[model samples]
Target: MKRSEQNVVARSSLPWNHSCGSKSFAATMSTKAEIPHFVDFFKESHWSKKKDDWLDHKCMEKHGELENLRTMCSQPDAIPMSQEEMSVAVLGKKSGYLRGYGVGRKPCNTNTTSRDNGEEVIILREELSSLKELNDTQQQQLEAQNEQLAIQQQQIKAQNQKLEKFQEVLLRCGLLSSDECGEESTEGG
Candidate 1:
């Protein structure tokens, strides 16, 4: 046999190519049909098309849900959603975005077990500090509101006292009857 034929025979004799069989191998060598690489072949095959279609359907479904959420938000009576809640709704629970991970930080691949524990502790401490800061801010705002409310109450009391004195003067001048004054006071209260 010629060298090229000999090479073909040797190649076809390999364990993986045994499925071709001798006659089919000869026919394959004679045929003009190209043998595709596995990856390229799979790319054009049914399974690949099925997978792509499935993925596209999932993306469309998610897009539709997001559109609905946007529409709901545009409505006047819609409750406001926080960024974290929106992200969790759009992305699944397992997404790292909700946990504030994988952005400008290295993956936790420490050699020592203690190092991992230390990193976790640091993260917890940071979260705790942030929560404490929020609590302090809310407390300060509540105190301010309370102070304003107390001042308002005092002003209202002063206005009521002035109204009472004016009513007494009206009574002395016979402008308003005592029954009318009493009724006005009751209504105001």
Candidate 2:
């Protein structure tokens, strides 16, 4: 691994230090126009975002990603914002690894259409589970119904054979005449 990557690993593995103060979040863009490695970012962070939405100047400054640069540059806005307020706004706008944006922000999280994508995933999983359960039940019922129909068919076949034998015996004993054995019955004048 590169020295910078090793440093990152070291920092991550090191125990938490209360005195170490705040964390430094990496900005999507760096000064001097360094080519953004979006694919690399996503691969490393395991989060995806569009190329256009990767960078936002306000968010960079708010999240302290541009803090070092900010110290050297003049304040862009005259309105002084409280640290707490800035932190809250930044948190609300920032997502894990990927950037967060407020209302009217362009390129909103691709994962969500009108609601939380995470919630949508959960709901879909539940619906799928219910559908699977229903399918299993229907399949079981179908098998049972088929078995019952087969048994009924067998019983009917046996009853038909028994009735044929009984008719044949009656005919042989002259109890039922040939005309009564399903032949056309015509009355003599």
Candidate 3:
């Protein structure tokens, strides 16, 4: 065989096949592993656009019901409840349901808590602190802007008063009376 044809055969017979196959499989398995267990909870059910519409309808109904409950509770005759009782009534005993399904769980404490799979808790306290600082800065800016607006209003009021005084002086001096001023100047001349 020619040198080019021999090179092609050598390349085709390389161990790249085994390495590539294993790497691809490992990548696929890792991706699948990252999916939350809650996704499988609804897998058996047919997920269609209609299901999403139904969920939206249910959410609206629940919101309306909560609003009605709030109005009722605000009445003078309504019974008062403690915070714990209110929480129990609103959230029920299934508070850990999300954690059970591996969805929306609170971030694990880096200092003490440990996940079964040994994943490190991603600490974002520094990021959160920076965000809070940004919010405070924004609030300060808004307050400063309000104070500046008030100062501008006072300045505008002062300017208006000064303009009124100037007009009054002009009127008192008879300078505002064009015809009278003209006739007086003509008689003097």
Highest-scoring model, lDDT: 1
TM-score list, all predictions:
0.42, 0.39, 0.32
lDDT for each candidate structure: 0.58, 0.49, 0.48
Query: Residue by residue across 1-189, what tens digits does model 3's lDDT show?
Result: 999999899867642222222333324334663632221222211123545532334334433444455566668999744322332344343454331122233355322336522432234666678889999999999999999999999998887677666656777887677565555446643
lDDT of 2 by residue, 1-189 (tens): 899999899867742211112422233323216633432322222222445332334433433533433233336754444332333344444333333211232345443444566787899999999999999999999999999999999998887778778878998999998777665223210
RMSD of every candidate to native, in Å, equals 16.5, 18.1, 24.7
Off by over 4 Å in 1: 1-110
Q: What is the full ranking by lDDT, best candidate first?
A: 1, 2, 3
- Residue 118 error, candidate 3, Å: 9.8
TM-score of 3: 0.32
Clashes of 1: 0
Report how far residue 120 has shifted in candidate 2, in Å.
1.1
Give the alpha carbon lDDT tens digit for every residue of 1-189 in model 1.
Answer: 899999999877632222233444224333537854222221222123434542234444544555566567668999855433443576445534331111221244224436857887999999999999999999999999999999999999999999999999999999999999999999998
| Candidate 1 TM-score, C-alpha based | 0.42
Top-TM-score structure, candidate number? 1
lDDT comparing candidate 3 with the true structure: 0.48
